[model samples]
Target: MDIVLGLQWGDEGKGKFIDLISENYDITARFNGGANAGHSIERNGKRITLKMIPSGIFMKEVQNVIGTGTVLDPVSFKKEILNLQLFDHTIQPEKNIIISKKAHLVMPTHKLLDIFMEENPEYTTIGTTKNGIAQAYSNKILRQNLRVGDIWSPDFQSRAQHILYRDYKMLEDGGMIVLPALEEISKEFFDAVDFLKKFTCTETEIYLNNALSKGKRILAEGSQATMLDIDHGTYPYVTSSSTTAAGACSGLGISPKKMGEIYGIAKAYCTRVGNGAFPTELLDEFGDDLRMKGNEFGSNTGRPRRIGWLDLPALKYAVMINGVTQLVLTKADVLNGVKSVAVCTHYELEDGSLETVSGTLSENIRPVLKWMNGWSADFVNMKSGSELPEELKEFLSFLEAALEIPVTYLSTGPGREQILKMK
Candidate 1:
């Protein structure tokens, strides 16, 4: 069985939930996104940021794999592995994890392009992390990218020289001054490639499929949310890759028949990173409280996130795309002290029309909110759905009713033990 999520924005506490569920699965594979994803898991009272690595890596029995559709930031990935090694000595390339050889490598020039694009003040900013994810994917689609397998080829140096010359010429043509060659760039790139070779697998599709035929359970994890999907999300502000459930199949090389359960994850409220149209966003003191209480900041970029109330149009739209079988609501406790809360049940469009949640309507309309009394109760150390405050239960019930999905999992805090399996 494969469990997939991300009904809301990127930081839906996916890492903690995936870590909690990893014990039941034989393999955990991350399908999409790049190092720009910030999945933080708290275990043994310690918090770790997992970018390229799967959040399930901390499990002793779980085998983690990075799928081909994901763009590789080898330097960041190497540092993450080394950081994990600091806590446990048993993690090694040959024993626990694997990387797809087909994954495109992120070059230094990609980072430069990312920075240049984000720093252009005249253009509308998409609030990127400047992590070179867009540039890496762009090169891949342009068919000018270098993959993991190319690092060991005899022509690697020549290929590098050719790529550098092309990139430098393009920058010069754009009237931008280029920096001098630094040895650190080559050293980091080569070192990352060498490190990745230890775990590169050419036939990830065959490996995963064969394992599935044996009835081995698998978990397909997504990095960003459906609202950030490039083709389906709000235009000019979405991520570079697909962030929906269908992406799970294309990203992991899995068949639709192999997909067992789809879990859509959302917070009790909503939060988004970068610049975009947020219909239900709160700009008052209440929004400030949600930001501070939830520690709502980008895990990868450390940028402050935009806080808002629940948008049902967005949630229902995600449900339709992912075919969500179950819902996992995170940070419900963050709304504990509020006097009242709001959920956007419908949208008021610019054309004076009322529409249900659709991607196009979301871009053109403003939300129509429904208010409810807030729940004031402490959820810390609480372990079960029965123990939850009555008001909190009411909130979840409303969410289920509005989205027509069951709420099976609830997360109160960042720690592993904080999750409650309600269903």
Candidate 2:
């Protein structure tokens, strides 16, 4: 199976690229994350933001799988499936989509707890989407969570109630007030659980292995990005789960040896949502211009993203961790009007020593930028690398030499067809 994931923080235009490339694969499976991750795709002049569903859902020939390592919110899943069904009448969720039975369900209390934690003054907020991802994963690790398969069992409702009350007690003990009534929340939760039962739920690990044995091509779609991985990313500022290529194995139940190409997706520039140590962040008017031109807003939260120049050191760190074989540079057209483009190649410490991305980054570090002349060509409508301007070609060449990775794909705009396959 091949993997497609973000190399930067998040919002690296992964959805459009996945949708553009899914035609070659028989299956496109989401490996990690939940409703907190949004992939927006535009096709036929209409656009839709996908949360839990894989971007390949628009393609009738490709089967989309929600794998085991993900946490599912029944309400959000139901809403997404219904929305896609209404958007395209040809999409039959029961026929083309598969939900892993081992996937954990996100409870209402999880979201409540998420809000409580973020609102609490005693702790530093990670700027979560308040989707209950961290709380849901906490329940999973504690073995007090509900799995997708549990909805079919006789004690499903009882088990869910037990966990809900447990979480409520924990929250109350933690000084949380203004809790929603149990009856009101349970009604909606159970209703969404009922709605979730109509879909195909099975052991996806076995099914995926069987399909692999049959030589079916599988595309593992990663949510979030490598820089947000729980263990590998910047601590406390990272997501709840792994978002690297190795995550596809445990997330989708595929063997590491079965992995093929790793497509690392990033923007021509960089943009991060929420808070973190951003060494190359642009604070000037050009930063605002990049945001306006690229439309750099969070699809899930609708918040403005923190814009910056491309950090080559961080990109190289992501490539190393994910074992990225090829790169896909996106949003190059966003840089069309610039006089020069800058990329950060290294970080200079307070003592004036240069360092690569060896560990977690601090806010005090300074960036060493390498600037190149910008291009003015309208490459959004261009389809071939031969049509690319000499200036843009020079920048890409420098990137290829620095990372030792081939630029296989380039996306100039948000439209699905705006991408060009360079290789």
lDDT for 378 (candidate 1): 61
TM-score of candidate 1 relative to the true fold: 0.96
Tens-digit lDDT string for candidate 1 (1-423): 576778777799888889889889999988888898989887677777888888788788888888888998878878878888886677664577877777788877677677777776756788888888998898999999997667778998779767766775676676656564535666676787678777756657777888898988889889988888978887778888988878888888888877888988899899999888888888998798789999998888888889999988889999998899999999888888888888988888787888677675345677888888888766786878999878788889988888888999999877788888999
Best by TM-score: 2
Candidates in order, TM-scores: namely: 0.96, 0.98
Pick the lDDT winner.
2
What are the clashing pairs of model 1? Answer: none
lDDT of 2 by residue, 318-381 (tens): 9988889999999888998689999999999889999866447888899999999999887757
For model 1, give the 10-residue run with minimal summed lDDT.
Answer: 175-184
